[model samples]
Target: MNTTEIFLLAMLLIFTAPYLVWRFCKTDYFAPLVIVQIIGGIVLGPGVLGAAFPDYYQFVFTAPVVQSLNGIAWWGVMLFVMLAGMELDLKKVWQYRRESATTAGFALGVPLLFGCAAAMLLLGYQGWMGVKGKNWQFLLGIGMACAVTALPVLVLLMEKLDILRQPMGQRLLRYASLDDVAIWGVLAIILLDWERMGRQAGFLLAFAVLTPLFRRLMARLGEDDRWYVSLIWLALCGFGADWAGLHFMVGAFLAGVVMDAHWFEQRKLDMLFKHVLLVLMPVFFLSTGLRTKWDAGSYPVFFVAGLLLLASVGGKLAGAHLAGKMLKWKQGEASIIGWLLQTKGLIEIIFANILLDKQIITSDMFTALLLMAAASTMLTVPVVQPRLHRESHAGLMQQASS
Candidate 1:
């Protein structure tokens, strides 16, 4: 009932939930631990069990607790971005430059077109229950959502499967990374009002012109013994962006990209990020789950959601697969790559949550997008692993014959 007691209880739950899940479930089910932590937060919050044990739940889910957890999540994302940047191999990208460019372009362009089209049709129908917005903004939002690819999840999967060092994996990772960068640029463009396009254009030109100078400054600062300088710079970037009407996360991401040139030591960055990922990333997803509120919207909304999910999946698969074929990949390998690239995991949900928080999309639309992300991720492993394994075996067999 007391503050200290509530804090203790929350800590107990956080520490024990993994153990409990592991004890009851198979080792393969460990991924669900992240989900459990999130659901636990919701159950213990004001939404469900909190209604019954008001005192205990309220104390546990206090504003301070939520804020603290959110801070951890943000740090986790920062580390994730850093790791992603560290993984960038300019050599590999150069090797597959044409293929990577084509794949990234198709992956992004197809989805953007489909999403915008869907938004136009859906927006005209005011009776559509779950959808949000009724004009160009809605179309832009939908297109943005559809264009997202979960770079963090893709990188983690590639690393886990030991494919990060492979040619195919390298290509996929490069394309995905470029895709993310493109999406961020697109987001910046989308978020800008038409009237402010000139201002945005000027700002972008200025940022571009200053990027080399900024990189040199970061490199110099990085050489200093005081690592806190990076943190200070990060804070200034994030706060400055917030003051300039953009989300802090955008600033954080751009900051990571800028600092990326200096932080090229993968091993050191990996060690730092591993801790952050294991501890703080889960909290971010948990907070996300806690904040999500799903309710029945209009039938049209549900229909549109279903359609949007289909369009998202299909567009990515078709576009990526076509690009792969154009690059002379075998049919099965191309299919596998397409499926792998189709996955939308925590990163996509994080973006959706940002849009939701900004009131750019409705709750129903958020729920639908979340569902799409979960489905895409769940489908990826099953679809790609077997095919890739077979290909690996065949390659080994050919080597033996030679």
Candidate 2:
């Protein structure tokens, strides 16, 4: 088959396989379609499918076809990240400053400390650090990866749990928003290339100067025009960031972060986000899976993944429990909050991909992180549902008594 046909075939598989597994298996209660797609990507990757069927894997995922898929994945993730930035409610965080700060701080900090320790251990042994990775970059990158909260996926899961519009949901968003800012800021620090330092500094300076002008221009435009121009803006920012040696994803986030969410109609913005997830993100998931490697062997990767999961889950829970104590949250609140906050979804995968791209983390380490993220996300709903239900039941009983 020609390269175009092969690429189409690849696309067909990317969309169809995951949906079929998700729908037919009815994994929604435990794992959402997104999770299933992520699993599907890993399964289709070289480590799994390629090992099992080398010739077929090579035939379908030829160099040109893989490159095409990569192009799609890059744009898809950039747009996804941009939307995530746009979703940040800085104003709301400011409104609830004390609680947001306290929670977001613990939520990010504890995991980072734990993850850094894990990275140190991994680096003590062979085969974990990437080829070009320096010690600080690897440690910080891995540390921040543990601290990441997939705000977009958190929104989806909260919506699924029917708490997205609740007071609790809004509270979680505030915490996550603050962490999102920190996550990207830390990423810029880790990605800082001394050789390209001047270029990166220039980019930030230019971004600072242009951001307000961009906002003013956006505000003056009609809604339709704003939407169209935002895309143009996104592309330009992403290009500039990549050129500056900070990844395009950073620029994409910056592009959206400076804009007010109110500029776009909420419903339309939401629908477009959903459409992007449905149409484009699965390909990104697949590409992510393709990048996974078990160079140190599958068993070792799983073992390391288990260790990272322990750190991630334990640190998040500990941090939340501490915050709850300080804030005087009700009994059982911390566990649910912690588990929910521990979710490492698309954003974690994206972080891992960036690390891999920069060679700050090896493929084996990437695979481990991927598994950790998948496990953490899959655990969120199941763990949180029963607690939420019991809380609702108790609330109803108390209301009846009153």
Candidate 3:
């Protein structure tokens, strides 16, 4: 009917469609609700649903409605990124510097190189690179996309595996956290606009000067006040970064990393994540899906998706196994760690979105990356659960023999 009614109807689909499939189909073991939501978004996007039912799709996903949804998605993801940043334990990462460095380095570097190779393969084809994107930027953007591990998603999967509070889980977080920092750093490099380099420099300088003062202010406030102030700060940093030619998510992350996690109540922080995912992130997924396209042809796009997936999984495993060899880890340890770190969920999509915004990657490339990320995430639990069980059984056998 009206725009308001249409927007409400769109929101209905965003929340309900995925939940029904996820719950009724019992896809939890392999495909979590988040995975279902992402797949649903793709299915509901212009390329699929709109192509199939143009009038119905256009009616529901009108310009104003899509814009509203995008605004919500932007804030939702920014807040999500902030939470991820707040979870970083730089102090602990430094404590185990050598081990963390080796593991994180291999985990990120090897996959990065593989992803670059994959990018090189795509260069021969048309419709993959964004017009505004330089050859090196496209390569590095694709490379980093493969190397990402969604720290928030990793925490959830580890919790599901009952390993989140374990020593190994802590180790995994350390490694992911370090990689998380590097991921954003690489993104900044990719998003660098030469014409706006001066503005970007000023943004960083201002950020460094402001961060400590902001931290001190946060420390002095009551928890309730801190939350409100943090939101305000999040908005301002996002604006500042966008103005400086960097993405707003970078600013949102800076807002979080500067604040001590201890400044907020742990239970509140948990609720923050829970509520954000439940209430907000689905819209982001839907918006991401709307941007997906088959411009590179379905076959080539899917083929590229397959290639990226292979590089992502293979490189992560190779890197992890190499780390295990150097550190003398137990049998089957690398398998579990490698599979777990291969996860690339919301963060990868967000990374690809940023690239798309700057015209680094075309819609087809975005779609392929989206597929690669969703498939990688969906594979994590199924693959790792069996490996964990097998590893445990072998450990028991060795103990009995002893």
**Among all candidates shown, the one with the greatest lDDT:** 3
TM agreement with the true structure for every prediction: 0.82, 0.99, 0.98
Worst 10 residues of 2 by lDDT: 292-301
Model 3 ranges off by over 4 Å: 295-297, 399-402
- Cα lDDT listed for each candidate: 0.65, 0.93, 0.93
- Model 2, residue 109: C-alpha shift (Å): 0.6
lDDT of 2 by residue, 1-402 (tens): 999999999999999999999999999988999999999999999989999899999999999998999999999999999999999999899999999999999999999999999888988888889899999999898888888889999999999999989998999999999999999999999999999999999999999999989989998999989988999999999999999999999999999898888998899999989999999999999999999887425588999899899889988999999999999999988888888899999999999999999998889999999999999999999999999999999999999999
Model 2 has an lDDT value of 0.93
Off by over 4 Å in 1: 2-8, 11-19, 27-59, 82-95, 117-134, 193-213, 221-226, 261-264, 296-306, 397-402
The better-scoring model by TM-score among 1 and 2 is 2
Q: Give the TM-score ranking, best first.
A: 2, 3, 1
Instruction: After superposing candidate 2 on the true structure, give the runs of residues whose Cα lies further than 4 Å from its correct spot.
Output: 295-297
lDDT of 3 at 315: 92
Q: What overall lDDT, based on C-alpha atoms, would model 3 receive against the true structure?
A: 0.93
Clashing pairs in 3: none
**TM match of model 2 to true structure:** 0.99
TM-score of 1: 0.82
